[model samples]
Target chain A: MSPQSSVLYDAPGPRTRRRTTIAAVLIGVALLAGAYYLVYRPLEAKGQFTAVKWGPLVDLADPNLPLVWERIRLGIIATLTAAALAIVCSLLAGTLLAVVRMLLKEQAKRRYAGLPAAAAYALRGLNTALRGITRFCVEVFRGLPVLVTIFFAWRISGISDPLWPLVIGLSIYNSVVIAEIIRSGMEGLPRGQREAADSLGLTPFQAILLVQLPQAFRIMLPALISQLVVILKDTTLGYIITYEDILAVAQQMIQILQNPIQMYVIIGAVFIAINYALSQLAAYVQRRVSRVRAHKPAAAATELAASEPVVLDA
Target chain B: MDVLIDNADVFVSGFWLTLQLCVLSATGALLIGTIVAAMRISPVPSLRWAGATYVTLVRNLPLTIVFFLTSFGLPELGSNADFLRVPGLSSVFDRLGIDLPYFRFAVIALSVYTAAFVCEAIRSGVNAVPAGQAEAARSLGLTFRQNLLSIVLPQAWRAAIVPLGSVIIAMIKNSALAGAFGVTGELFSSGQNLTSSGGNPIIPVFIGISIGYLIMTVPLGIFIDRVENRRAVAR
Candidate 1:
């Protein structure tokens, strides 16, 4: 409202103000009624609100009561396990892909200077073919839903554990998105940094490693974390292929308890809790990075950040 | 290849249904998303809170989980089926021979999922509107709604087309999840049927589907980019 305060309409006059208040009140009431009818009434009618169905929740301390706590506990571990593996793999894969993409760009700008004609010709052919392959892989993975990739990977991976399929699927898909984030992050940096490193006799690889990657990683931290949260949420897709994740446990409970409402609500809450924490960590990192960057008058908040690369998850 | 040819009908129907779910839900998500976006920018605090809460709640949960809630939970409410049995409504579905229950919940799930993303994109668009434009609208004595409708949103939508198109592609991908939940005739379910038909067709079948999706999505991205570049040039 501060920047957005339009001078177009004056502050509503008393009558108009009253009308706005009334309309707001009506909307609030309608929302409440809509929620009650759409959600509450249906739940209540099915006896889902009753203590007997929800009673198992409170019996955690009672040793006599059998519970799926162990499964749920294992499910949490499994989800984290998949997320951790996928995060590492995607980061490595993304970095490699980003480097290759940068190579493609550099090759396009190649000058044939200081090279043998045959060597130059070979490099050009290799560059085009490499570009073509990487571009297709990235586009295919990015275009297809992660769910389909997971399904395909699960079937064709021919691995014993379902875990490998989910992790690989999540990695290949997310690596493309993360690569974009990395590439954009590097592009946003002042060319001066790399040029200065080169003037100091740093090799291109040394300049990139010592000077550029750190800056790009810092700039891309917020985006990287969001993609990680995407990876986290995507582990739920593991459940569809019957991977032992939190969602699968939640689904299993419904068959036993006949409480899809309560079960799904519980599952949804767990996901919200985990994802909220991850995003909060991301928010904290962004704030810290921005604060430090602000101290140095860095133009780190580039327009590239605004072009959010869509996260593809399995 | 022969496996693909043999199951050609299944793939066709699946692609058709995937397209249907994608289009319908994208439309629904856009409408509801616009309203939610409006609520966020409204002068009223309560409406803003409601809009913010909806986005947070929906965006935080995965679409698969949302589908689980819709397909499993909504049916427990019983009204979903009862509504289909309503006097005049049941007849329309009957004439069309659509299984109202599964289709309704799938659409609901997809809309409920995609709408949060659509809201974010449109809200970003709203934010992108120059302050001067809003000021100009206000100076001309335009009401809040009038300024939004006539001045801000028109510009916003143009800025929004690319992001919104990305959301549509994501929704198309997500429709495969509905097939997971027993919604018949989408690529995921068709792939499942093909798999059970035996011999690692899961590879060829889903690879074909991935190719199908790429064909659908890549063109969308290109078209949007073309328009976006043209718009930029015009500006």
Candidate 2:
């Protein structure tokens, strides 16, 4: 079999493929050597850096090693905590609002079914306001960059803590996104599903919690995971305000070390690895969730998909 | 406040330069990004791999690095230190028939970074189009370019609006980073100028920087949103 067919074929028949592979390997090796020369050698020549002391990554004894560890530790703590809080809070708030809107829609549909015309107009206005407010909040948050928002929080808010600023900024911005996701998910639900729940005498709250939310979360998991990745990246923005996140720490080291290229290359590799792992986790969860309801209808699947954030924040 | 008002011309001129930079870089980036995107989704694996790697490296790395690379490293590469200090590298390159140095580097970096994002946006947009659309166009005897330009692209562009909008906004924000190295008339320029002149609070300087971005982007954001809402209604 040709190399492309088996997905693991050893037959390297194409001259171009073989050349390209070799070239890529060489370039990678060259990049690694260049990095070693730029970063590792500079400190090594100074005698300020000891390889043995830096060997234990978690140890705080060595100045260089501690600084690196602290930066990574701070970055992880800030990002993971903020993302967890934002996801949980946003999911709850979004789901609640979605349910409320859904209930309102159903009530409006029922009341307008045989209503007096003037009364129906007032009801429509109210519904419009709810939708408008939801959209407006989402837009305001989405429109502003997360860095600016975080900066504002740090500048004006009572909380002077770096981590709080990141959490608050990311949470508020992501909450807006999460709400839109949930609203869309709710919209994707079939009228019949709600109608069936209603006909069976289930309260609106019960119908949403029992019949809708579980399925919506399943669809939303991948999008949520993607959002988590964005949240992870935004944590680096803390560096701008002297917030001591990983990127900030790296930038500081670059200034002190005077080796921009090597520092950035290292940080980029780390970021890519972290994000790749997160995405893989997301995919795995998505598959596991989907397997639980392999036979679900298109409407349910659509609703589930809607509940997840579609746009990956860069 | 009065001092700032008195030097309003400086601010205005700065604003103008910043606005120009934002628009110029955005346009340049979009064009570069589109080409990169095409290369990325090309049938040839080498082009596709190159495009993918470019986007991955650019997107994963911070914009500050790119800014520093052009601002600091490029000067060292060229023999003409005197030429590098000139407002535009065009003079150094003008000897070689090139012009527009300050704008060129800013635009190049902005385009390179933004192109990475644009590539992703375009790739996603292209992917969103069902395979059948291109297949149908192909089956009908339209050339590949003709099919892309006439049919595939128009549809992809529309679908790509959300991500594209975000990318453009990001470019506007990134244009400020250019001030860190060169381009004194940009948003970051005002901060650099202010710091050098009287040493106002950096927070306020950054705030001003952000406000400048808001003025450039918020309107564009509203427009994209209206388009999205219209699409939603149509659906």
The best candidate by DockQ is 1
Model 1 has a DockQ score of 0.56
Candidate topping TM-score: 1
Over B1-235, each residue of candidate 2 has an lDDT whose tens digit, in order, gives 5545555666666667767666766777788889888766544455556667777677655565566555544443442223324446434323212343556577667777788788778767766666677777767876656877887789888878877887887677656656654665665566556755765654565555555666777898888879878977875
Q: What is the C-alpha local distance difference test score of each model? A: 0.77, 0.64
**Best-performing candidate as measured by lDDT:** 1
> RMSD in Å for candidate 2, one decimal?
7.1
- Candidate 1 lDDT tens digits, B165-189: 8788878877878887767777777
Per-model chain A TM: 0.86, 0.69
Instruction: Pick out the ten consecutive residues of candidate 2 chain A with the lowest summed lDDT.
Output: A1-10
Q: Tell me which residue pairs clash in candidate 1.
A: A8-B138, A8-B139
Candidate 2 chain B minimal-lDDT segment of 10 residues: B89-98
**Per-residue lDDT of A1-314 in model 2, one digit per residue for the tens?**
11211211122468857775777666557656875876456546654244442333434565577666656576656556656665676667666666776666656555575778888888887887876786566666665566656665665574767767766766777777666666665556666767888799998778887877666666667777776776666666666556666666666666666655455555667777777777778768877666654566654546445423245445
TM-score of each: 0.90, 0.70
